[model samples]
Target: MRSLTGPTVETIIGVVVRLLADERGESEADVRDELAEGGWELPIDSLRLVEILVQLEQELGVEVPADVESARSMRSVRAFAEVVLAACTTSDGSPSS
Candidate 1:
């Protein structure tokens, strides 16, 4: 998980929307709206969702394991934040769980 120094879910959600907008040639606000009104499905496709997670991993100095079941359930910003937090550890790299 990443070390969130700000409003965790809000910050990450903004990042996710911005990344999606950049990848899709759209505006962040549009992406945010799409995300805000969601079903179990994400605003972007599965590939884009994975890409967002990967970007978060790089930006936050965290490794979102490929086999993490919760990682596949990022239908909402808070849920995705929880997944990232679950992967957050202390000084070393082992899972804090």
Candidate 2:
């Protein structure tokens, strides 16, 4: 697997969070705090997290497993990216590192 880039991950998380915040008329800080409250290291709400994951999977052409429930898979932005990247690498016939 390719090394994770902090900026890339941060950018993705920020975009998703911002979108969710805007849609819900909530402050970004509140969203971040909610994720923290949920014990997520990267900090994001569950619905927004699922939306971001679905978007990422579509954009990246990655096939994330459907078996993992929404709560488990969308725990944090970092975890979401990790799972997507890993699933992409394996599902697209790329050699896994």
Candidate 3:
């Protein structure tokens, strides 16, 4: 839910990876590679996924209510981005949905 603005998709992925590394106490590079291997190209659900979500809410000052919709939307990096960007932006972070 954080208001993250950036240029590259990799940069956004990197930010999420860094947060996972910090909270999960795992090697950042390892997490990054794991995410990449999982076809995520980023860490979406390392050990600290919930912590990262809480941090996002705190950082953004937005409440992403816990529910089935939120759960389904956070199943991957791009999905999470779409949800967060929708919560933070008007355009849903895509040209079409």
lDDT of each: 0.66, 0.61, 0.62
Candidate with top lDDT is: 1
Clashes of each: 2, 1, 0
Ranking by TM-score: 1, 3, 2
lDDT by residue for model 1 (14-92), tens: 6666677888899988777776667424676678778888887776676666664665657666677656655655324
* Model 1 regions more than 4 Å off: 1-7, 89-97
Q: In candidate 2, list every pair of residues with a backbone clash.
A: 1-97
**Runs of candidate 2 exceeding 4 Å displacement:** 1-45, 69-71
Q: What tens digits encode model 3's per-residue C-alpha lDDT throughout 23-96?
A: 76899998878877898744444446778877765665446666677677666776665565555443334432
Ranking by lDDT: 1, 3, 2
The C-alpha TM-scores of every prediction are 0.68, 0.50, 0.63
Per-residue error at 37 for model 1, in Å?
2.3
lDDT score of residue 76 within candidate 2: 60
lDDT (Cα, 0-100) at 85 in candidate 2: 57
